[model samples]
Target: MSIKSFAARIFASHIRNKIDKWASNPHNTQQKVFEELINKAKDTRFGKDHEFSEIKSHSEFVKKVPVRDYEELKDYVDMMVEGQEDILWPGKPLYYAKTSGTTSGAKYIPLTKDSMPTHINAARNAILCYIADSGNSKFVDGKMIFLQGSPELDEKNGVKLGRLSGIVAHYVPGYLQKNRMPSWETNCIEDWEDKVDAIVDETLKEDMSVISGIPSWVQMYFERLIDKTGKKVGEIFPNFNLFIYGGVNYEPYRTKFESLIGRKVDSIELYPASEGFFAFQDRQDANGMLLQLDSGMFYEFIKVEDFYSENPERLILKEVEVGVNYVMIISTTAGLWAYNLGDTVQFTSTKPYRLIVSGRIKHFISAFGEHVIAKEVEQAMKEAVAESGAEISEFTVAPQINPKGEELPYHEWYIEFEQEPEDLDKFAELIDRSLQKQNSYYLDLIEGHILQRLKITKVPRNGFQDYMKSIGKLGGQNKLPRLSNDRKIADKLNEII
Candidate 1:
């Protein structure tokens, strides 16, 4: 075997042993992890305020700390941002991860020394697990390109501020740093368009083995590479075999990315947010990601169906049922206690628990009583793509409420197409039909004449890109919401189109 493959095999074996031990008894591992986290933070202000010293069990911890969202915890985070130590974690955060603020205004999430390792380690474990399961380690021998945000961190109140990708880029291990592409100077470029161009220029002649990034930005890089070299991605990087991605569902972009690369590649999905690295695709054959139970984050679940209720029931790992959507609540080492991350997920396995992200709590449309979610919308789009043989680059859905009897209420879709179908009307019809099949309320609205058929507006080429550029949110972990209850995104799309 090659030297790279030999090294990968050894590392994979070590990671697999730890995973096997952790998965052997998830119940015990989870309890131990929670206890350890609580004890470590007990002396901190948040822990003491919640009576963490007196709390001995999971039930006691739950009773003391109530579930909270980002807005609710903003005040405490503000204190930390002002250079206060031991306000949340044992010390002030090393840096703050600034989220894209697509749903709300930009959020400043804390990243402490204690919590940073979880991000790094979980990412490493994801690769190790993939290596162990797939026995494909040649990718590790060559350069791996990670399309990330600018690495230049801005200082705020004596704390560093930057995107998660940028922050993580700084902490990439010294050994792998040598093999990682896109030089540090290039990564620090603030302008995404300029940064992508620099990346394409630098890595074009390198031996690329793996690529990792959000699908949209990576697709842009692929397009630019093809434009520059006049060759398919696989032909340009003959050794490239793995595509690691997250930030959004991959199903919608699968066909388009495959077409760009000119071949199929193995993929690994990760569930990492600014708050914590929650899970990663561990098994090659499994559909869901394995929860990072050993990560320094304690997890809880509140059923999505019960979320808006006056009092929602919070369930622990043992209590969560497979296939039920739940709002994840986490108490992390970074000082967030019972914090709601806003993302919705459903468990797919109980033992050695695994889950799939369903949607965002704030990113749903319920106008006209036709409650539609991200999953349903994505599924419909996928079906439409299959039936119409069209390729979509990006899309967003919003309710187009009638303006005082001017027109019937309906859903409006703004789509950027890579390859438009032969018949646009048929493509729209297929999407509408697929959505109806997924959502009974949507189907009822159509059948009962409560709403008109969905309207598909073909966005001009590069319309979404221009919109994002105008708003200064062009790339790196920023994504347009698929479904919205309001016309905030739609109104903006209207202007760009």
Candidate 2:
């Protein structure tokens, strides 16, 4: 093995051992630890002196602050963009992380020097815990690998800052920071599309062992990697040991990715954003046990139904029930207070607060009285495709109701596959059967027969990526909206149909 690969493997192995030690310890209660952190965050931002010098007494600061969101920090970000003092902290902000949030096109989230330690600590804990869980602490003794953003900076300051990925790229370990592939390799970099092709070219040459990013981008990368190498992923990257997937659910793409690699790839899911790295999956098979950076921020959970009902009740971590879906609200050290991310999750257990992603609350389809969640739809599709003895290359579902004055509303499935099914009718029936069995709403709608039918049409291969690229929003961080509940997406799909 090359010297760099050998070193990376060693580092990877070391990180795993550290994480295993932390995960197995009984004294680390996320709930208690994080609750203390929440109070610290409040004092830092809201104390009378605009400073967080001393906060030894927790009760003195617990209920003093109100929940905050991005709206509260609008002025703070505006100040930083103008090179003013940091509105969130005492000093000026070194960089800003940009993210596309719901109801807002793009939000510039400021990252301060004060919150740096929290970010580093949480991220390290996340990595080490994964290593312990995988029984692959030995792999850490090797060189480090990071699938990260571009290193380019702005011309004026010679500091290529401003993008969310770029801001994160700035914080990588100094020793391995130089190992990052060009920002151009990503289909994004804020403005420059000049070297999109070159970026893709150089990435194929790198010795990547640990890959990290949203599952969507990894999906696109594997497709390109397969085509370029003319060999399956297993043959090309035999040294690759871990695959870290975050930003979204990895369930839908899990089987597909595992099969392509030809071996079980150790994976880690991260719950991070431009705002902060809130939580990470600490155990391999424990879903995601939240390691509350109680020091970085405070969390509040609003029950899924209560969030939508006339009277909304937000619960504390201690009051949270297992198996109940809740909307996450976070108050961070940076600036955001009581910010609702709009994502939904359910607890697998509350003793440690392990959660399973339910779906985005706003991304549900309710046409024809058949409420379909993205998680349910994804699971149904996976089971359906498996049972049909067919492989789905790409697919999307658009809810079309009463088109051309029809009385019923049903889903229009756009499917694409490599090999045509020998029995197309059976393929359609299998998908329908899967949905009927998995989703209660779909089952009820089918029994009532309120919806006319579930229609499946084969589209060109890579059609999903084509759609994603057309929008200029393909790859990591950005995802193909599983449930196109908006009129624009629905109308666009209708046009394609």
Candidate 3:
């Protein structure tokens, strides 16, 4: 092995040992984190308001603090934005990660000194673990590209504000500064397409060993690279073997990516948000990302089925069961207490607490009492694509509550296909059947004739891209929902269908 690879392996060994030590006792680790968080923030304004000093246990904490999403948490965040120290965390946040919100135009999630390391370290550790497991770290010697928002900052009350990915850009370890790519100027280009072209120009001839980005944006870059050089991505960057991605499921895009790259490359899935870096894939053979129980965050889970129930029970890491859909809640070093993250997760392993982000709590279709989630639709599409030998670029599902004639209401899927199925109607049935198998409610709706199987609307090539562009959200962590209860997405898609 090369010197760099040997050193990496050594470091990986240390990191893995550290992870295993804490991960072996997840609940104890989480309890320590919870205690630390409570201790650190007990004197803060939020802590004082919530009677944190009196709270001694999870049950007491739960009673003192109610689970809150961005909207509910905004009052405290607003005070923090207006330069109030001790409003959330102990002092002013080091930075504010500005993310888009549905009702609120933008949400500024605090990134404090204590919480920031978890974000950067989780990403770093993911790679380290991969190297340790695979015994390959040659990529560490070559160039790496992280397709992300520009490292530009807008200040609000002395707090640096930018997209989470952009803020992360500024925090790329000094060791990686030389290996990172696109050049700072290229990354700063406001237009995503222009930035991508510049990226292609800069890295076309250089050695690129690692590439990380949201799948959709990275797909665009890959397409541009192929078009420019008339070669597959694998050919262009022969050393590129590792893809680190988050923000969306990669399975549905796997086939299209393989075709684009002309080979399969290993990938790491991350579960990160502006709030915190929660989990990451630990082993190549693992079914899910290992939840970061040892990270400076404490987790609580509400069963998805019970989430809407009055006073839904919140279970801690030790109380959680595998394979159940849960709405994850957290009290973090970032000072987000009992924060409802909005994303749903399913625990796949409880021994070390690993989970997959299942779907968003709000992004579900239950128009006819059949609560179909994003995971179900994404998995169904994966199954359909595998079975039908078809390729999809992007797709979304929405309930068609009312039909023009006397036709039954059904789920409408807007699909952009790279390779169309031989029988489109049959392909739709395949996806429907997959969904039925996964969700019993959906099955009952179909079997009872309350809804038709499903209708496939083949969108024109690049339809989703066009839709995103029209809305001025072409890239940079922007992803359309996998499914929705309302016809908002479906109605707009019908214009081009």
Residue-wise C-alpha lDDT for candidate 3, range 1-497, written one tens digit per residue: 66877788999989999998998988789889888889889999999999989988999998999999989999999999999999889889999999888787789899999999999999999999998888889999999999998888999989999988889898887878999997999988889888999999999989999999999889999999999989999999999999999989999999999999999999999998998999999999999998888779999999999988989999988888888999999988888989999999998998777889999999999999998999999999999999999999999998888888989999999999999999998999899899999999999998999999899888998899888887888888888889898988888777766
Clashing pairs in 3: none
Candidate 3 lDDT (Cα, 0 to 1) = 0.91
Model 1 clash pairs?
Answer: none
Q: Which is the leading candidate under TM-score?
A: 3
Give the Å shift of residue 476 in candidate 3. Answer: 0.5
What tens digits encode model 2's per-residue C-alpha lDDT throughout 197-256? 444466666655666777656666666778777877666767677787676667656667
What local lDDT does model 2 show for residue 440? 76
- Pick out the ten consecutive residues of candidate 1 with the lowest summed lDDT: 98-107
- Candidate 2 regions with alpha-carbon error over 4 angstroms: 1-86, 101-104, 137-147, 153-161, 175-200, 203-207, 289-291, 404-407, 418-439, 494-497
Better of 1 and 2 by TM-score: 1
Cα error, residue 101 of model 3, in Å, equals 1.7
Return the lDDT, model 3, position 143: 96
> Candidate 1: where is the Cα deviation over 4 Å?
100-106, 156-158, 403-406
TM-score of 1: 0.96
RMSD of 2: 4.6
